[model samples]
Target: MERAVRWDRLREEMAREGVELLALVPGANLFYLTGLHFHRMERPIVALLPREGEPALILPAFEVEKAQRAPIPWRLFPYTDAEGPASAFHAAAAALGGRGHTIAVETLGMRVLEWSLLAEAFESPTPLPAEPLLARLRMVKGPEEIAAIRRAIAAAEAALQQWLPEVRPGMTEREATRRLIQACFAAGADALAFEPIVVAGPNAALPHATPSERPMGPGEMMIVDFGVIMDGYVSDLTRTFVLGEPDPETARIYEVVREANAAGRAAVRPGIPAEAVDRAARAVIEAAGYGPYFPHRTGHGLGLEIHEPPYLVQGDRTLLTPGMVFTVEPGIYLPGRGGVRIEDVVVVTETGGESLTTFPRELRSL
Candidate 1:
C-alpha cells in the first residue's frame, strides 16, 4: 500500500473538517495506515496522524523496533509497563500540538480506556467521528487490494471444497469446525476471517449461530458462512448446502435466495445508490411471499474489514463507483425449518458489477 498517498488524502480531509489530528487504535485503520498489526491489549496503543508533520505513536517499549520497520517514518514515544502510558501520551500530545485542537477518532474502533487517556493527556480536546473520512478513502479499493481479495477468496473456496468431503451425517458441528480450520491453514490462509458459522437444520435459521455439539443429520440444511485472510485482505462467502436431497419447501427457499442474490448483483452500476441493490433483491423475496423471513441488510462493503461502508440497505445513498467492492448476499430463514443464503463478493466496474467469488451457487448435496 502507498501509505503516503493515503495519508495525504486523510490530511486533506482533516484540514477541511478542522481536525488537527487523527487518533487510531490497533485494527484495520491502523494497519491500513502503518502496515503494523499490534494486538489491542490492556497496554493501550495509539498512533496519531497530524495535519502537518510526521506521524507519532504511543506504544510499548518492546514494539518500538517493530514500529520503526513501518513503511513511513514516525516520531515514537515508547513507554514501559512499570512507567505506564500517561507520561508518553502527554509528551506526544505536546509535541504534536494536540492540546485544545479538534481531534478525530474512530467511534467504532476506539475503546473507553484509550479515549479516556487521550482526554486527560490532551486536556479534553473536542473529539469528532473519523468514520466518514476514512470510509470515503477506504471504500474504493485500489489494484493491489483487489488482487489480495481475489487471493483470499481463492484460498477460502479451495479450503471449503476440500473440507466438504469430510462432512458426514453424524459429524458434530464443533468437530466439523475443527476440520474446517485445519483445511483453511492447509489451503494457505493467513488467518480465519472469523469463526466459521457451521450449523445444521434449525441452527442454520440463526444467521450468526455458533457451532455446537449437536450432530448434523441427513437431508438437513447446512449453512456454511466462512471467510479467510490472505495478504491482510478478507473474503466472506456463504453457500447453503444439504446433507441429502432437499425437501420441496427447502428447495424453493434456496431458489428464491439464489434469484435474490442474482438480482442484487445485477442491480449494480457505476451511477446508482447503494440501496438500489437491496431494493432489487428484497423485491424478489417479497414477491415470493418471503419478505419477513429475510433479515439483515442486502450486503456490506468488503476490503480491509469484513463489514464497512456503502451498505446495501435503505437510507444509504452513496453512489456506486468504480473500484468499490462489497458483498451481495440475500437470505431467507424459516423459524422452525431452515434458512437459505447465497453470497458473493462483487466489484464495481466501469460499466457494471463483476463477481470476484467464483464458487458455484447451485445447490449441491454433501
Candidate 2:
C-alpha cells in the first residue's frame, strides 16, 4: 500500500507535467516502482506506466512470477529469449496507446537498445526527459525513506568506529580498503555503496581515487570515503584522518574544509534555492583562497542512487523543500600534495537542516 502511494504520487507528478506515459528500463526508477531488481543485461526489461490505465510490466518470461508479488497490479507482458522483446514492447505500446502521446523516459539510464525498441514500438515517438518529473516525485523523501537512510548511516559509522582503531602505520591503502569492507559487513551492511576510496597522502588528491599499494606511514593523513547500503537506501560519509600527528598546513586545511561543510549544512532550509547551500559552502573555501582546488559541487541529492537531483552547485535554482536529503561535502585538494574533505548527509526540515551523518567531524589521529 505504501508503494502504491508512491506510484500515485508519480502519477500526480506526471499529470502535472503533461506526461501521458513513463517508459523505464532496468534501473533505480524501475526498482523503485516495482521493488524488483534486474541486473542490466543485453536482454531488455521495460516498464510502461500510463497515467490513466493499468501499468504494464514487460520483462523476461522468467521474471513474470516476481511481478505477481508487486504491491500494485501490473499488466504483464513477458517475453522468452527465443521470442525476443519486440512483441512485448509492441503489445505494451498497443495496450497503453503510445502514438502521439507525451511519453517520458530516463534519458541517462535507458540504453540505446531500449530506446530503439521504444521508438519502433511507439512509431518513433520522441520521449521527453523524465528526470524533472521523477525528481519532483523523488527528491523530498518521506519518513520511512529517511529512516532507511539512517540505518545505512548507522552501519557505515559503526564500521568506521570499529575499523579506525585497528589502523596500523604500515598497511597499504588496498589493505586498508579490504579491512574496511569486512568491517562494513560485520557491522550489518547489506552491501557497499561504492568501492571504498581509501587513499593516503598524495593519492588523496584525487576525489575518486582508487586504492593503491602505497603504505601509509605515521605523520601522514588518509582520506576514507565510504558508505553502506541498508533498507534499499545508501549513506555517503567521508572523513580525513591522521596516523599520529598532522603537519600544520594539513591541519589548517582540514579545519577549513570542516567549516565549509558546516556552512553548507547550515544553509539548508525550506524555500531557499538549492544553490544557496553551494554558495554558502564555497564562500568559506574561497575566502580561504582554496577555491581553485575545490573542483566538484558542494554536494548532491542522495537516496535511491548515489547521485540524483537538486544538485548543490551554481545555477541550480531548485528550491529546497522539507524532506529533501543531500550531502554537504567540501574539499581542498592540492594537485601534488594531500587533500582534506569532510562530507555529511543532511535533510531539509521545516526549521532547518538535520544531519543524518553523526560520526565525529573532529580531526583525530589514529
Candidate 3:
C-alpha cells in the first residue's frame, strides 16, 4: 500500500498545487520522483510529468536504455548527435504545448545550457520554482525509503567499528581512512556518500578537513566523519575518539558536546519549531561556557542528499513532522587544542525522535 501511495501522493500534490508540468534533470529530485540514476552528458536527460497525465522522458539515443528503468510511466523522445541534445528537449516541450502554461523546474539541478534551450522553447518563459512542491512530497519518509536509510546506517556503523582497533598511534590519517572505507564495502555498502574526514590532533579542530599524511600521536583527539550510500539513499555520521589518554580538558569538552547532542535530540517533538531544537543544544553548550567554541548549526536533513530542507538551526520556523529524518550533531572546537563532533541520524516520531545510529557517545581513549 505504501509503495503505491508514494507515487500517487506526488501526482495529487501536483494537481492540488496547479502545476501543469514538472521538469527534472539529473539530481536528487529527479531520482526521488523516478527511480532513475543516469549521467548528465552532452545529450541531456529530463523527466517531464504532467499534473493529470503520464510522464515523458527526453534524452539522447544513448540514454534510452537506462531511462527505460525509471519507475514513472514515460514516453521517450530520443535524438542523435546530429540533432544535438537540446533537440530532444525541444521535442518534449512541443508535447507539453509550447510551454505557455506554468512549468515547474528545479533551479539547482538544471544546467545553464539546458535552461537557455528551455527558455527559448517557451513564449513567455516564466519558470516556476519546483522546490516547494518537491520538498512537500519528499519531507515524509515512506516505508521503503526508511528501510534503505536504516540499512545504510547499519553498514556505515559496521565500517566505523571495524576500523576502531586499527586507530592506534603512528598510523597516518589517510591509511586509517582507507581501512575504514574498505570496511564499508565489506559491510555491503554500494558506494560512499562523500570523502570521509579523517583528522587527528589540531586537524580535528577544522570541521570537514580532508585526510592527510599526519601521523596519529599519543593523547591526540581524532575525528572520523563518514557516510555510506545504499539504494540511492545516504547515511551520515561522525565520531570522535582519542588515540591514547586525552587530557582532562579534552574529556570535559567531549562531555559537553555529548550532552548538547542529547539535548538537541530530546527537543525534537511534533509541535516544536526547528529553531527551538537547535537552541536546545545551543543552550547546553552555552551553559557549559563553551558557546564560543561551538560553531555551526546543530545539524541538517539527510536522505536523497547529504543536505536538505528542515535544517536544525536558529530561526528555522519549520515545524517538526513525524516522518521527517535528520541528524543531531553537536561539536566544540578549541583552536590549537582540538575538537569533538558527535552525530547521528534521527527520525521525528509521534512520541519523540528515534535515533537510528546508537554507537555509544561516551568519550573513548584508545
Candidate 4:
C-alpha cells in the first residue's frame, strides 16, 4: 500500500508536468514501483501507463507469475522471445489505449532496441526522459522509505562493529574489505550499496581508491567507506582510522574534516538549499587553510539508488524537505600525507535532521 501511494504521487507529478503516461524499462525505478526484478537479456520487461490510470505490465511469458506477487494494481501482458518486444509492447499499449499518447521512458535504462520497439508502436507519439519527472517525486522520501534506509544503516553498522576489532596494522586493505563484504551478506543484507572502498596510508588521499594489497602501517590512516543494501535501499557511511599513534598533520587534518562534516550535518534541515550544506562544510575546511584540498559535493540523496537527486553542490538550489535523506561527507586530502573524511547518512526531519548511521565519527587510533 505504501508503494502504491508513492506510485500515485509520481503519476500525479507526471500528469501535472504534461506527461500523458510514464513508462519504466528495466531498472531501479521498475523494481521500486512494481517489486519485480528482471535481468537484461533476450526477454524484455516494461511497465506502461499514466499515473492516474491503470498501468500495464509487459513481461516475458515466463515471468508473468512474478507479477502475481506485485502489490500494485496492474494488467499483465506476456510475451516470448519468438514474438519480440515490439509486438508485445504494441499489443500492451493498444490494450491500454496508450497507442497514440505521449509516453515518458527512462532514458538511462531504455536500450536502443527497446527504444526502437517503443517508437515503432506509437503513431506521432513523443517520448522523453522520465528521470527528471520521476526523480522529483522520489527525492522526498516517505516514512516507509526512511524506515527502509534506517534498516540498511542498522545492518551496515552491525557489520562495521563486527569488523572493528579485527582492524589493525599489517592487515592488507583487501583483507579488511573482504571481511566487511562478507559481513554485509551475513547480516541479512540483500546486496552492497557499492564496491567497498578500503584505502590505507598515502592511498587514502585518493577519494575512491579501491582496496589494495598494501599492508596497513602503524600511524597511517585507513579509510573504510561502504554501505549495505536492505530491500533495495542503500546507506553510505565512511570512517577514517589510524592503526596506532598518528602523525600530528594527519591528526590535524582529521579534526578539520570532522568539524566540517559536523558543520554540514548541522546545516541540514527542511527549507535549506542543497548548496548551503556544501557551503557550511566548505567554510570549515577553508578556515583551516585546506579549502583547495576539499573536492566533491557535500553529499547526495540516498534511497533505491546510492546516488540520486538534490545533489549538495555549489549551485544546487533545491530546498531540503522533511522526508529527504542524504549524506554529509566532508574531507581534506593532502597529497602524500594521507587524508581524512567522515560521512553519515541523515534524514531531514520536521525539527531538524536525524542521522541514520550512528557509528562513532571520532578519530579512532588503535
User: Against the true structure, what is each candidate's TM-score?
Assistant: 0.98, 0.97, 0.95, 0.93
- Tens digits of per-residue lDDT, candidate 3, 78-182, equal 988888867677777787777576778888788877777777765556678888888877877877888899999999998888879877898999999999999
In terms of TM-score, how similar is model 3 to the real structure?
0.95
The 0-to-1 C-alpha lDDT of every candidate, in the order given, reads: 0.93, 0.91, 0.85, 0.85
Residues 1-366, model 4: lDDT tens digits? 777676778867887778887878777888877777778875767788675667888888888777888776788888777876677888876876746777888887788777676677765579877988888878988878899999999999898888889888999999989988988887878899999998888899989888899998998998889998887899899999998988788888889999998999899889889999999999999998999998889899989989888799999999999999899999988888688889999899998888888999888886
Off by over 4 Å in 3: 1-4, 15-18
Q: Write the per-residue lDDT of candidate 1 for residues 1-366, one digit (tens) a residue.
A: 487799889888888888888999999999987799999999999998989988889999999999988777789999999999999999999998857978899999899999999999999989999999899889999999999999999999999999999998899999998999999999999998888998998998998889999999999999999999999999999999999889998999999999999999999999999999999999999999999998899999988889999899998999999999999999999887778889999999999999999999999999
The numbered model that scores best in lDDT is 1
**Which parts of model 4 are misplaced by more than 4 Å?**
98-100
Candidate 2 lDDT, 171-242, residue by residue in tens: 999999999999999999999988999998889889999999999888777999999899789999999998
Model 2 TM-score, 2 decimals = 0.97
User: Cα miss at 14, model 1 (Å)?
Assistant: 1.0
